[model samples]
Target: MPRRRQAVTIRHVAADAGVSLQTVSRVINKEPNVRPEMMERVQASIAKLGYVPSIAAQRMAGSRSYLIVALNDRERTIAGWRNREGTDWVDQMLLGGMLTCAEHGYRLLVELVDTHNDHIARELLGAIAAIRPDGVILTPPHSDNPHITQLLEAQGISFARIGSVKPGAGFAVAMDDAGAARLATDHLIALGHRRIGFIAGPNEYELSGRRVDGWRAAMAAADLPTDHLLEQGDFGLASGRAATLALLDGPVSPTAIIASSDQMALATLELARERGLEVPADLSIVSFDDTPIVRFVHPSLTAVVQPIADVTAHAISLVIAEQAGQSPSTAPVIVPATMAVRASTGAPGAARPGGGEAQGYAGPPAGAGIVTEVSSDH
Candidate 1:
């Protein structure tokens, strides 16, 4: 019979590195002041042995679980996956969050919970009891949920809120959603589109309102009438289609339309085709999130590319930092979002200046992205 390899643990790493068990723990927890050469040697030994530290052992070795919990909207996320619509928000989040957590010797865990669950406290408590995460991150609808924030507050857990600007308990790590929306709207306005239409996300999300506000503000600034040009969507394909239909069938036909989500934007594109209108020629379209699929469409979408990975990484850092008693109480993060000019948008009568296909914008140089870190009493 083949021999079974024993599971590798921190002790094996310590023994192989010829260091004290505590030294290995320090390296695992990313504690400061460890000698550089010792850290290297310990890490080298761990790699050689393929030592995967046990999370339970980690919990026992310290007051932390070394786990960062991220809460996402349960219903919407599931629907997106089940329908195979394939939103890349979670993927981008993992790319940024997992990498950041690994650097800090932590793990990123995602939990799906109903945003409006009446037993929200119980759901949160159960998850909290099971994982005992070092910190929590609230995304989208949950970010604006006061109940979750209140419970996390009562339980003394460090959390970070993404896509929220409300003054609350958890650290607020947010994107410039409004600024990004304004950027998109302004781009369309500059392209000689007079009557631009705007489709907004659901009211449950705070960022949705912020985006709508930006679009409205930009239109008002351009001295253009926004009457009959705004429609509401739930960030879903069906809702987007309904909203797009209303905008197209309204009193005045808009030359350009901006949908607040990739799904919604795709719906707009679909609706336009149904109406026999050419993208960016007969109609110009812009959308948000800059999802991966948008680039492959017949008329690639012009999108507001929020720095998803960088923003997520920054949020993870803030959560871990706050848990470690570091500062950054209530400063606004300024992660800049860029407009990816594509074939979908144009000068009302003409296609966008370049070839319709375009690459998503890579974010700014490292260390320049601003992230809001809200500190807690904990």
Candidate 2:
């Protein structure tokens, strides 16, 4: 290897521009009262020398750290990365936030904080001390936690809540979880599925409950019976497996199922196979999250896409803009979720009553579990 290239610094820019360090600092920070000619000359020197200021340098004026911190649940995030499961949300969020932050000359930092820890305030306090970030983005449980929001508010820091609809403080960014579920449930109803089972994620997540509400809303609207058709999962494989078992083995088996997470959907698929049931034939499955893996699974999953990246990017913009005195509205940003129709869902497998022609999306006969045909008003 030849000589290692030396990193360019602000000092180099000042020297190249034949100006004092204070002048260069003001120019870099865009302080008021700097003559246009002087600012232009310093900027030219900075461009020519390819001088990139470090975060430490950027914070020398003590106004901003130029970093946006996003907090996620430590346990789940670690497990997701370790297991390589359907955990595309974090990756998508980071990608969108980082890219959007770059446009504002800010950096993104992802901090994992345990949701169950009683010392959450202490943990957040440590982060504030170490990074002194200008803003924060709270995800999932943290988003709905009053403790986290209160702490950030007391610190006078701008923040955004993802997947939260709670009132007060911070920017609230969320997807229409209920609407997404209703759309999925309607799809099944339109396919002549009367007894549709819903696999809900943990209640600790507000979004999970909203999805349940959506399913119930749709079923009630269609005048369908929901008895023994609802079960709870933890957005994990085991919980999904157990929920699927309960739904299938109950008094009345569902003609179709909607799972709140991709992993749970996979478990449903596995259980269906174990029961000698073919997808779209014996049991139709609709998965939530729609992670990259869902598309590649055997008999690809029909899924609800959460638009995680877009939501995250919007959150970043709101937080940054608030810090810049833009005063973005506190009203929740409702980015709607959409469905990806795939191979995993179709008409109930059992033949329609009296052999009526199957309606909705075309697919092979689902199997022998037919339900009464009803006009779907949803």
Where does candidate 1 clash, by residue pair?
171-374, 329-375, 333-371, 333-372, 334-370
- Model 1 residue 92 lDDT? 89
Best by lDDT: 2
1-378 in candidate 1: lDDT tens per residue?
A: 989988998888999999999899888777777999999999999999999877788788679888999998899899999999886998988899999999887899999999778888898899999989999988888988888999899989888888887887877777788788788878778778899999999899998888888888889999999999999999888999999999999998999999999999999999999999878777889888888898789777878887778878888898888766678656656576777776677666663336432222222222443312211111
Off by over 4 Å in 1: 1-19, 35-52, 351-378
Candidate 2 TM-score versus the reference: 0.84
> Which one is best on TM-score?
1
| TM-score, candidate number 1 | 0.86
Provide the lDDT at 109 for model 1. 93
lDDT of 2: 0.85
RMSD of 1: 6.5
Model 1, residue 80: displacement in angstroms?
1.0
User: What's the residue-level lDDT of 151 in candidate 2?
Assistant: 92
